[model samples]
Target: MADDPFALFDAWFAEAKAAEPNDAEAMALATASADGFPSVRMVLLKGHGPDGFDFYTNAQSSKGRDLAENAHAALLFHWKSLRRQVRVEGFVILLPDEVADAYFATRGRDSQIGAWASDQSRPLDDRDLFERRFEEMKRRFEGQEVPRPPYWRGYRVVPAGIEFWTDRAHRLHERRLFTQTDSGWTEGLLYP
Candidate 1:
């Protein structure tokens, strides 16, 4: 077993990316407020490196604010078609402004504007209001460079714990857990 969770994650993720029919890069991001109330939603996995896993969102969004307050988060990747799932827990850090700027610039112009149009996690009057706002943003940014909003950027979750699970016959499963320690990583098998 590999002591590095990231290596194991990469292996499993590669398999899913090749075999999963859709949204292979999607993950369920979980966050909690300072008080410990939890919330979760699906987000696209944007980047990965030795530093950690990255995703982008508005800083004022619920998940973003939760991370700001607590700086801790969890992630789950489930590939229903493959009967596999991975769970991760970690500390989150805001990405540098330059990194966010580059990523935002790469986004479609309409999407860049839409980031400024919708107030994520806020109650909306109706779909029409959202459509109207989207239209307004489209008009405003038409034939122009759409800059990344100050409130929009990316966050990286530096994982401390990760568990990979795979299904088998009779409900038996394969489970491997990797946890970071002061020295390095500790790997173990879990009964499933």
Candidate 2:
């Protein structure tokens, strides 16, 4: 494996993309509140590079609120078909408006409208009310592009550490941990 964590991630991700049955970019995002409560949820990995891994969400959502209070987070990617997993820990940075707008533009019209209508992580009295709100948004955006809502945006996780794990027979797994330093990343093996 290369000494560069990003390079190793790219190689593993490419293999995952080829072998995983579906949603190879799906990852478990873990966040916590400033007070110490934790939350985990599945999110799609929208983009990744040396800068970090990116994902989008409603700013007022539960996970979003957690991120706002505590910028540190972790992500886990598991490829069942390949029996491999990658763990990433990082600090979150909100994406620029233009970047968010560009990604939003690629979404389907209905999804765009949903983004406008859904008050994610909020209480809803009834499904009918939600549906009506969605319908209203659809009607309002008729014959016009649905702009990205102010609260809808993307965030990048600038990794401080990364760990790669591979399954092995007799429960003897392989683990490689990479920690970022001022100069670059330093790698080491972990007992598994």
Candidate 3:
């Protein structure tokens, strides 16, 4: 298997999916506001490449706006089944328009419509109102392809540092980290 940090990410992800019983693709995403207040939530991991780790959401959403103002973010993947975890922190960049468009177009129709219907992170008066809007969108776009809304797109985290951890008895686990620097990737072992 590839040992490059990015390639290792793929390998671990695949292993997690096979071992995890549920929501294997979900990752804890952490982003901060300009004032340094932090927010964390689970979001689906959509894409990964040499460029970075990608996920999609409305740009106007709270997390989205926070990232827009502060271009750094972190991601954590914990697989209880495998007793392993990976943590990443890095600079974020917006995915190119074409890449976002392609991924959006591939989503199921209902999912695409849900993305348009949701005014994410905004106030919701009640469940009825929210579902009404969703139903309305479903009805209006029935049998037609749902177009990706302008507000929705993708962001990729270009990792500056990544760490992998494996659990062991007595908590004396293994920890290894890779950090990008002017000289290229620098690796080190961390005491648990």
Candidate 4:
């Protein structure tokens, strides 16, 4: 096994991309509100490295609101096909507007329009109402490139700790934990 957690993660992620039949980049993001209420949701992992893991969403959405209230989160990546899982705990950092704008520009036209139409994490009385808004947004941005909404934002979770787990016979799992220290990362093991 690689001594560095990031390197090990990179290798495992590569294998997952090839073996996982579905969205290999998907991950579960766990966050809490100011009042300490916790919530978890699936989000696509846009980027990752030693710096942190990156994802994007509407700033006014449920997870976004939670992040605003409490800038800490956990991420879980389960590559079932590979019998591996990784957990990350960290502080969230808001990415610049430029990053969100650049990513938004690359999205499909309908998705861009939907971003403007949907009031995510908010109550919707009727499906037709949202459909009308989608049409309205489409018409509003007709004959021009759709722009990124101000509420659409990107974030990174700067990891404080990371754990890598692999399955073993009889539930004797192999677990490796890496904790960020003042100088650098301290690698350790956990009974599993």
The per-prediction CA RMSD against the true structure, in angstroms, equals: 1.4, 1.0, 1.7, 1.1
What does candidate 1's lDDT look like per residue over 100-180, in tens digits?
Answer: 999999998778988989999899989999889999998988888998999998999998988889999998999988887
Q: Residue 160's C-alpha lDDT in candidate 1?
A: 90
Q: Each model's C-alpha lDDT?
A: 0.90, 0.96, 0.90, 0.95
Residues 1-192, candidate 4, lDDT per residue (tens digit)? 348888888999999999999999999999999999999999999988999999999999999999999999999999999999999999999988998899899899999999999999999999999999999998999999999999999999999999999999999999999999999999889999
TM-score of each: 0.94, 0.97, 0.95, 0.97
Q: What's the lDDT for residue 1 in model 1?
A: 47
Candidate 1 regions with alpha-carbon error over 4 angstroms: 1-3
Clashes of 1: 0
**Cα error of candidate 2 at position 148, Å:** 0.6
Model 1, residue 124: C-alpha shift (Å): 0.8
lDDT, candidate 4, equals 0.95
- Residue-wise C-alpha lDDT for candidate 3, range 1-192, written one tens digit per residue: 126887777898899999999988888999999999999999988988776789999999999999989999999989999999999899999988888899999998878888878899999999898788889999988888787788897999999999999999999999889898888787888999
Question: Which 10 residues in a row give candidate 4 its minimum summed lDDT?
Answer: 1-10
- Model 2, residue pairs in steric clash: none
Model 2 TM-score on a 0 to 1 scale: 0.97
Q: Give lDDT: candidate 3, residue 113.
A: 83
